[model samples]
Target chain A: MKLSDLLETAREDAPAARYTVDDVVAAGRRRKRRRNTGWAIAALLAVFAVIGLPQLIARPAAPPATPPPPKAGPFDLLFSSYRSGDLRVGDPEWVSLTNQLASIGREVSPGVYRSVGRLVLYPAGSVPQTFWMSHPKEPAGAINGHEASFMPLGRSALIKADTLLTWRNADGSMVLMASFENRLSREEMVRLATAFRTTSPRPARLPFAISWVPSTMRLVAVDVSRPEAATALVTPDRPDIGFELEPLYEQAQFVSAWSEPGLNSAPQPIGLSFPRSTPGNASAPSGGIVIGVQRSFVSGTGPTPKCAPWSGQHNVRQCVAAPDASSNLVARAGHDVPQADLERVAAAGRIVGTPGDPEAWPTARESFPASAWVER
Target chain B: MSDKEAEFREFVGGQMEALRGLAYLTCGDWQLAEDAVLGALARLYGKWGRVENPQAYARSAVVRAAIDETRRPWWRREQSHGDAMPDIVARDEILNIDDRVHLRQALLRVPVKHRAVLVLRFLEGLSVPQTAAALRCPEGTVKAYTSRGLDTLRRILGADLSIDERLEARHEAV
Candidate 1:
């Protein structure tokens, strides 16, 4: 009984600790209020726009006496597939391409060639949808991986200026194989697949359309002019303009694994809001670009930003559509900075001047494609 | 003061240190235990009129809060807990400060729920029923946890230390 009494004394003698209930409660209240404010702002914007005059609405377009037929292209359908992070010589990287490109899962560029096509094996497995390069010649299947595993087929040439390998997609588009052979592998095919998987694409800024080629490794063609400029896409010869290359993310400060697997991220900043036009016309879509900083497990993958801020235009500014790829030919009102500054911003990741073959660089000029430039 | 508020103040004054002790055993860090208890008490104050027995309610709240903190974030762990076994002694040795501190460090490494049961059974002098009431568990659970906690404590602290030595270390710390 005496021992029991003493135990109570120890229990009751411990000192009480301190904390703020108000702070926790206050944080909760702040979160609730922020949600409420968001709803209120959305409602106010809706009401204000609704109350605006009929002057805000634009009239319909005058119908043409004879509508023109849809224009066909002199363009190559460029498909993009990549492996991100440290894809040692035998791993898989996720690959995504413009809907036009299909991963037929086999070495052959499907349908383009009859059964006489070359057979290629991919570490992503031998699926039938893995087709990319254009075919009509000798049977050759080229397998590569980047942000994910890919099984493309092609022949490649190395840029005499650098070790960057250039390959042709089965479809004749250009691709550059990034050199990230940091790990050892017993399987030759797996080693080749992994070498492809660890590569990253070039800087694809907004006001530009980046198309992929698999012939060489890590090459991208930028179309600042879109659809119409598709005809002006960069090729091995006959460049339409003189341009340069810049590097936004230096090659040394990169890791490949962080952007791998599902590439699952919280609300990606790279967004393409489809453009809107009047009832019959195409939509005029606009969006913002953010400076991207990519961290991964390899060296080849580099930084590419979307919609980086343009000088003087607090917001909306039109990208010029030059019929010919040479220099900026269009200008608009309310733009604060010179077109030259806008040109420099567009050149943010380029290396400048001709360093190698015109095919080695995705731009038509073999330096920087004027077709991909935006002006102030 | 209204009767409910006055009753709450008196009840809190009575249970404050005991609840703090329970929290300390759960979290091992005196500071975090204090925060857990104080937060629990303030919430108790808001429910002063409705609670049936504020002490038990607050004790349960402190235990739950301390456990949650242990799982989700840091609760100021004793760096020594992982390296050296907590100090414990045979029933024959004289209780000392060094032994008490080492024992407390080792006790902190035990599972928080297990430590709480040990504190309630031995440190608080709760009968099986009282400990169950405070923990909002059945008396059978209290007994099982008490047995398991003692076994784990003995295994962790070394077989030389007996229940009496642990009680004496508590006395030395006080």
Candidate 2:
């Protein structure tokens, strides 16, 4: 066969595309928005450096407010179910564990979930939709006499190799064991894979509740580090204005987008009393609204419950600081929605449980608006 | 859909498959190839009207994206559950499937850069200058890579595929 014919044949049996054209358009809009936002931030920083910083420096420095009592770290709830002190949940160094972008794994044991790196557990049977890159599989000998294999979990330009071992548990659930920093050898990985077991599915919970969202928006994706961290991306049904709905998630330092597949279609019904038009959002279309809510870990001395316009070029955003300043709720809309309405939605953000107690936290269904719950 | 969106959809419909094939040849992984195409096409969608030659831009972008996919952190790589052989050509072949599979395996053994050059020149049938433009490398580098890539393939297949000498001489004299 001609080399060209062989090349054509190689791509002949590709699986059906997992994403739709609309998803592509939506992602493009988001990328464009992110680029625009990055430029805007750069410009704002330049202005701040040129004009804003000098005035601040020239002013008398106020004494730092007495620090509020140290609060629980954002990931405290992730370890809520584990009664044992043996498993360290979130260490300063483990921050790399949360950067998988979109990864999910099942709970292997109580307080011991096996996700990308962090032990944060995902609901059983959930699979990642977008595998960011292709991993070429290689053979690793059997583990515990059951068929087993391992794949290098590093990028093409790998510096420290990570390996992922997979084997079938007698219970039929696949057990995935990953090594971090190349610390575990092939034998150690196999041993862990052989020993690990997955427990029955447990629902993930959140530390905060969003009692309201704009009527038109729906929950699309969620990134949660159980017990302490959670963020959800909620946008309208329209695909055309996805750029206007780009996540302001970066506002919260801990959370990232859950790139899980099929999560986008999991929209819950939203009950509505919100008007179609609001004062500051006159130009914002109802279909262009996006709302993001995150459990805040930053401690500030500012007065409770402040709402102000957030940044964006084509959208109006209102970031409402929770009463305890323990969570951040940001509402965004195309240039048409009234800013007051967006504020009202953001201000509805409520901390539903003690920051350090995972058992006290609400399940996603309980915490999110009726429309934002993603049924597993 | 607006006129711009309609135009983009039409372009995607026409070129998506060809782009996928090109990316697969470049990256040697179907999943990664699809990802590269999707990403490149999405970027194309963002610049739909502004890009003067969408076809060329997409071809270059898909190849570049596919290469980048190989460089991404392993943590971001997909985890397959099965113990399948490496590079299992998808299961739709009928005629000379073994030959195609062997050629593909041999082609992958060529270094990624040289392999990219070979695919563009021989498979995509681009001239040395065109391949260099697509790869953002100099013409001489393209020529050298093409020669090195063909030599490697000849060694692996042990087949005298001297047909490219004429093509190379013609381009070298230009």
Candidate 3:
């Protein structure tokens, strides 16, 4: 039997199957709409939080009897989860700098890492959650002409219970408070208070400002009151630089950022089990940021690689690269997807956009997305 | 939640089944697809009042929600909704069942770009132009995908698929 006859026979045999198309289409379209609405709502809430959050975040109208428990002293020189038994003898350089600050009452504690011996440098007597930095180390080899010096820490927000904040001094010496509740996680602030020989103290009103856009992984702002006010410096002695945050403040009306040099990124591949994704079979690199598909492809494996040669695997996939030159790549998109769905994620991005650099903006069309090749 | 929640619940009752089927096609996993549909319907329930094309809006919601559900870090920890092993032996019985399994297998083998087209064209019975309109792709792309999909299906189903292709040509001439 030919193709049409086969289809006709199939249709005659299973008239119900005809509905599968409409069913799948309707479901996909609704689901996508549902997701976009959720994201829009979530984003709106985030924006609202930014605007209306002042009230919630506003220091309590009635001050607490005692300020929250300050974080422990800067315990830089963190140990490796795989290697170290003690926090003192670790490899990360940020740990070393933190340890030096700790010698003089600076405070630093790990925020989020496997075995981070974090440091929170603080002034003589102040709240610990003031200034903060995760493993900040310089890039090895000939460094780029960028500042990796210290600036005073500014405002602090309790992103989590254990996490704290701190600021760098103008002399570029790290200073500020990092707070922690129990001992689960501590900030640099407690370390500073101890250095000043204070039993307990809570510093308030951060000395700086920082902002991040998920669309771009960059933080920009300045510590208006840093003591030394040196350029942000990078000093990764060996390979594998640690987290060094710098300002990328640009004077713009809409929104601008002070770019911190160096790309601080990890493989954020989302572990998506596409019907097409096989067991232990290599999947073509793919992923994209659509209106609703945040962290596409599941989050465990991390973000899909954007470029390099590869066949598109899943419709939900982002940027994909082929495994081989001739390995056939067959991207299977369901007919159910609305025309708008394809255009939603396939927007034409910049030829090359640098991460953390807001200037490298994605030229996205609000309505129709122009597809672009993502070959890194 | 007072009045709005009740109203949304009523609206969801109407759209749940259709949404679930669509979700199943998208993920190819029934339970996950149902969850995705529920999640989408729940969200739709929230905005039932403001939605213009409630059904269209719901459809979009399902597609995008399923997509996001695929993105979570925890999503990796989960895959199939059930542990039913694939039935390779009982796959090629009736053309419909065979077609479903065939399409599913071929779809799994096909790249996303082509698969979507196949689903839109063969399953959805959308004309090339309708598919282009639905996919927001150029007509050429719809045609290209149809051609490419047929070729890929040929490879996966081998001889079985060829007979079907010949049938399709005969039907088109008729």
Candidate 4:
């Protein structure tokens, strides 16, 4: 038989598929939900970590509580599904940043720079819902006779860039919907909030671990769904330092740790030393340190690590390539951190479990040494 | 249903069988092939609205995912239907069945990259450039793998394989 005939016949006896289109759609929806929430949570965390949270801690008090509306429309379907069009609706994913909630959004354009209309659902008795319930709310008209309260706030009351619509569900759950960049009108925000639905809650996961951390730092934010990154910001010692953590290995295998100056202080360390990533006309952050692990294939076993400086701009990072060349671990310390101490921190890192299996990797909370974590 | 979802369903319904067949050939086991296709399709579903040509995306993704499945440690994959070579038996009266079994064995014997090249070039009717694009390799590398794969098959089959080499030659000429 000809080669084509042989190839065709070889695949003929394969069994029927074990999954259906619906199964694929369902999985897709879950992934989309997880990924969307992951990005928003990461952004919120980045803001708090990099910019500092003194303003949040200094709130005088929430204004007097507003009475609940007499009636509200059913919003059960909004969380369970998606909306498409000029204002494309996204799936809801669980948020565990400060409180347990399911966060969802609708966007005008699905790009990084585009504004997303935000909706956060807090379960009854959650800290955020209770705190929000204590605050006075502005009447923003009604949605199908259900009274809605509007607040001019962004992710939180501290950043007042967005217009927020708040209300209570029949189940005593609290819903806060914000129109980012004023992309959605007050009426649109009310309508979206009224039509909102709920889906299964999905919690994010951390990709890497840290066995040691300085006493002054704490993990303030994490984005686990898509890029799988976390940030631990330093407090008290100096408000300017923070660590950016992510998985470095291909296919999200090896977890890594990076450090930089405060968000408002300077360009991120990665952008400085790596020209390909350099932000426009940005200067390197001074008095900052960075540590990361990079995965690469090298022939042979038990090769000693070779540590050296990078050839790129800023000329920072003392890197130690693994003996097998399977990975490269680097420590870049500015004047703030002693070089020896930075090396000690870098030395504490070791890849755990089977390299490629994500399940085998330790949880972000589990990956770090107990001493490394500081509760706020 | 949203048009995005309906479109994805139609695409999946139409392409599911062909993709399964492609994946099975790429990875030598049915179970691994199925897993690879499902994983690829699940990811594709998330990007359904954005991906301009999902068939091309699914084809490349399935092929690569199948390759990745093969890279899993042998002991781990042993729980599944492993790719252990079968013993050669005497030629039977059922010539088609015997030839198919023999052909499968021979195909597995070829190196994975070369085997992938052969599958893409022959079964999928992809030209050297198209195979190169699918496999993300140079066209010259595709030609070389095709030659090496054909040689391996010829040595095992113990026959001069009669297949059109004209497509490769024609593309090379262009």
Best by TM-score: 2
DockQ of prediction 2: 0.24
After TM-score superposition, the amount by which residue A144's alpha carbon in candidate 2 deviates from its true location, in angstroms, is 99
Q: What is each candidate's fraction of native interface contacts (fnat)?
A: 0.15, 0.45, 0.12, 0.82
Give the residue spans of candidate 1 off by over 4 A. Answer: A1-376, B1-3, B74-95, B159-174
Across A1-376, the per-residue lDDT of candidate 2 in tens digits comes to: 3455555665566667665667667777788898899999999999999999998997667755654333322222222222122222221111111111212222345434343332212222423221412356667777667687666764333222366655654543343444545545676555444444433334445556777776766554344443334454455645553311111011111112122322221221012111111212232444444444444433442324444554544345544454455455445565466666566666676667775576777765576677654332
Question: Which candidate do you rate higher for DockQ, 1 or 2?
Answer: 2
Best by lDDT: 4
Q: How do the residues A48-127 of candidate 1 rate in per-residue lDDT, one tens digit apiece?
A: 67775343554236655555423311122222343223222211111111111111111123212111111122211112
TM-score of each: 0.29, 0.39, 0.28, 0.39
Which residue runs of candidate 3 sit more than 4 Å off their true CA positions? A1-376, B1-15, B64-99, B125-143, B159-174
Could you report the Cα RMSD, in angstroms, for every candidate shown?
Answer: 29.1, 38.9, 40.1, 35.6
**DockQ score for candidate 3:** 0.05
Candidate 4, TM-score vs. the true structure?
0.39
TM-score of chain A of 3: 0.19
| Candidates in order, interface RMSD in Å | 6.6, 2.6, 8.7, 1.5
lDDT (C-alpha) at residue A148 in model 2? 71
